[model samples]
Target: MIRELYRQYKDRWLLELTFDRLLRWNRWWPQHRDTGGLLCWGSDKVPPDEAAHTWQGAAYESGLDNSPMFDGVPFNTKTNQLQLADVGLTSLYIADCNALAELAQVLNRPAQAAELRQRAGTYGQALQMLWSEEKGIFLNRRTDTGQFSDRLSPTLFYPLLAGVATPIQARRMVDEHLLNPAEFWGEWVLPAVARTDSAFTDQNYWRGRIWAPLNFLVYLGLRNYDLPDARKQLVDKSNQLLLKNWRASRHVPENFHVSGVGRLPSEALNRSDSFYHWGALMGFMSLLEQDKAVELKKTTD
Candidate 1:
């Protein structure tokens, strides 16, 4: 399956574009870990397959609010040198770095481990300071308005779930942001940003939708951090949400509302671009594996 997926994706346009998005850093690029370290941040609201949304991936594009430049970090693939591109939202680095760290640990790659550690440090510093406690979320550090995005999003969970924060950091973060009954436990936690935060709206797909991949990140992040009970609860709840949706709509929708209502299926192309879209399946199966979650339907709503 791995070999087939590689063969299937290797020379496609998406892969071409994906490869083009690698780090453009001048001297700080790694020579060993480039394959995993993204040279650019992903678009804000668009799924990987769409090009019309934030348009912020790998190129020095015509539009983008490049920011939060991470300096002097040193994880890279052997094929590539230092990777330097526009640093994206805090969540991006945390999730990727944590995954990198795990891959390093599992593969017994010491150099990659060192690089992942340094990158995690930079990401942690950013998350701790960047979060506006009053708002209970991390805002995009764009140059515009000099104001925060004014939303509590799934992005915040990435840092904690990705193994970027220490235990103290995780506990504080979970208490303050996630595990809070008032917020995180909602019908599945409203989509990315909270509805009460002046940023919530039904049409704002990402801002309020309950995305599977993001939830998966939370489950995996908590599991990686050794919060067994917390991880179990989240995994269980997330699975409940998925099964609920699967039952209602025979087919698994890309995402759901905080209300647990499935959204209309997207009409985007490259439906087969697993990495680019339909990442929700990955989340569902992940939780299912851990919690013995069930699939209630095969036909999507």
Candidate 2:
């Protein structure tokens, strides 16, 4: 996003201003969250009065507050991280490194760019270990027990965004998981949890709801590969989701039902914040798709 901002506005000063802080944040993840070289979501010590100071704080850091992925996962107080080495956190960190590296290059800092690229490569290698040939997708592993979490979410597809999954691995993931009706793919599409998972019935926040950010991130990842069919489906369905609510109540929702059952944000089961800006990202995906189509047409013309 920062890169896009710089690209659109050509603001060198803005990139210069934010570069160091972004670099620090990229560095902080591995330094503090590293568990056997793969990252986990963690929290630093906080005051007793802090509501999220516990394991819940670590979950908060994952941005999936109540995801079943962390259910009964132990918190390593010693490391201040969840015992699970998260595929999502590690993949996102790699993406951050690559993004920061691009910013470093733009700022004419070759040494910093090299360092960031090296960090991304090292972590990318570690992330590859999370891939399960049997499952045909990456799984989060418990650092304590070295067991893979059976729970799955859209975050697993983040490896594509990080450019870590090989073409074959990416194909397997898409064919066996992403497009599977029993899992993430459906009429509504890309549920936070697989339809087969018990959590899907909850239809609560992260349990099985469709989140715009998840769809957007996964959509970005799909753009990295040759899956035009999947990409178009995602863009079309995301646009449909946005329009369905917008045409009904003139509201963009914070999230949507995985089953495509709700129309208004006021619906109790939907549990969405009406008119949330993030929800508009569903529409933004279509805009991006349209922009790409125009660019392709111009090139072919």
Candidate 3:
């Protein structure tokens, strides 16, 4: 169903939001563009406000609500309506473009496939401008200043998932950053913020918590780069955390505390839903493992 929809709309205005996000080329952007990256319903005069209620438009888009990464970054505020172009959104858009290209190929639409692939590659090129050599991580660039955001979130690793990072970059990110105990790695693994960052706080949603989707994305990137062992380690840790939480609370929480691994802190403010489907990503794990098996079989064959 999704593939058919993609086939239908891939050529149309489906890329309008993506274009606005990647380049902000649209001078006359729609009101939905102002709503924290969410596609909301409304007119040019007034639209549903996501960021007005809380300063979490971009964070919400990343599924990490209240991540400090968006701190001080005005997005969809009453006083200001800023369109954020973060590395995560750009990379994800690139990935989506590539996926749609594959669907086009399956339908024997070579021209459409080539066009989508080229578009994806172009977006990937644009995404590279966000790389910060000093930080050794990709940061979000404000469309306003075209300057990178100082806040480093787990979304930094998303370039790898987009297949935009070079082999050397991926190695450095996975080795020096993602796997570093003082950075994202801990008991549960892959906190939202680097442990060395002052903003990092265990149990804080998106501040330092472990999220299944975040790890799953990194896992996909690791596999894409043929780092099977690292991918396995991530999958193992993620599964362990989920199982631990399930055993303790008899359900999975939206995000798990880095300090406690599987347990949510009772005293922690701004608690999340104890059970959310997006965080589960159960089928994602199965699909990844299955892909791994297929790869292994192909190699042996």
Candidates in order have lDDT scores of 0.48, 0.89, 0.65
Q: Report the lDDT tens digits of candidate 2 across residue range 122-152.
A: 9999999999999999999999999999999
Q: Show the colliding residue pairs in model 2.
A: none
Ranked candidates (TM-score, high to low): 2, 3, 1
Report RMSD for candidate 2: 1.7
* Maximum-lDDT candidate: 2
Question: What lDDT score goes with residue 48 in model 1?
Answer: 56
* Pairs that clash in candidate 3: none
Count backbone clashes in candidate 2: 0
Q: For candidate 2, report its TM-score.
A: 0.96
Alpha-carbon shift of residue 35 in model 3 (angstroms):
16
For residue 59, model 1's alpha carbon misses the true position, in angstroms, by 13
- What ranges in model 2 sit over 4 Å off? 261-270
Ten-residue region with minimum lDDT total, candidate 1: 62-71
Which candidate, 1 or 3, would have the higher TM-score against the true structure?
Answer: 3
